[model samples]
Target: MGNIICSHSLSPLSHSTARCHYLVPTSAYDVFINHRGKDTKQFLASSLYDNLQNRGFRVFLDKSSLRVGQYVPEAITCAIRRAAVHIVILSPNYAESEWCLDELYLLIQTGAPIVPVFWKVRPSEDRMEDENGVYAKDFRKHKKAGKFSTETLEKWRNALRWVSLVEGFISEG
Candidate 1:
């Protein structure tokens, strides 16, 4: 472990919020948030970001870290590469966004420890659905377009555990 860098001690490159799009880590981060733009409401209220930061994990949100006119793929690739853990906020609309799917692929490739937290946005849905229903169409489209791999089920298992962590204990209260 290295000596703690005071907030003022951070060079611009280490700060995720820098104007030049530098990644200065004053401290190591535990999780990187991969979510839909519209799902920010959940992130905000969950206080997950703030809680993680308070616990000393530097969580990066796209709106604050990404710069305008930058290469979207490159930016995300960099962030995912640097992250120690990735948290996929799997809402109904998450897979619908090409960007989030791209991030998922990159995170998989990068082999970052991922925690997929499914936000149960519906009271009716028992299983995943496609664009024709209450969920995003990506999963179904992929299945119909071609045979899918077992890896997807493995990933979903990880996601289910994440959801259980928050929900199981949450409801116990």
Candidate 2:
């Protein structure tokens, strides 16, 4: 709604290809990419980011867009909240990382339309692997580790279950 500002619009960023570590969007974004860093960061996330940017879509990708900051989670939260749509890539390990789950939950909570992409999980192997997938294993780990609260875990579980039911893309090879 407001003016667009990012590495391209800001100082130092406007001066060169050199980008700032700032992750918060100065203007509304067209797309926000949510993915497991190890799972799809290199291939799917990178490619989609490039393609979307090339098509003149304002995008927020943490690895490329975020400026140097001690709190990465804060930046991620900021980007997720302002984006127009979310490209959520659900990989095998998506549930393993607390951050990824947090992002997914935020995407759901933000009321943005999510485009779910199953990274490596075959649809035949597991239904809803892309939408919801088998996150129970990692969830159990979190529970056993005494890391996440009951309310937080429930939110993640509900998000996954809800996302699985949404009409989304299924990447199957």
Collision pairs in model 2 = 21-66, 21-67, 21-68, 22-67
Native-vs-model 1 lDDT? 0.52
By summed lDDT, the worst window of 10 consecutive residues in model 1 runs over 3-12
- In candidate 2, position 146 carries an lDDT of 73
Using TM-score as the measure, the top candidate is 2
Q: In model 1, which runs have C-alpha deviations exceeding 4 angstroms?
A: 1-28, 41-46, 67-70, 121-133, 136-173
Q: Write the per-residue lDDT of candidate 2 for residues 84-136, one digit (tens) a residue.
A: 89988877888777777667776776687888776665432223344344566
Residue pairs whose backbone atoms clash in candidate 1: 13-24, 14-23, 14-24, 15-24, 131-137
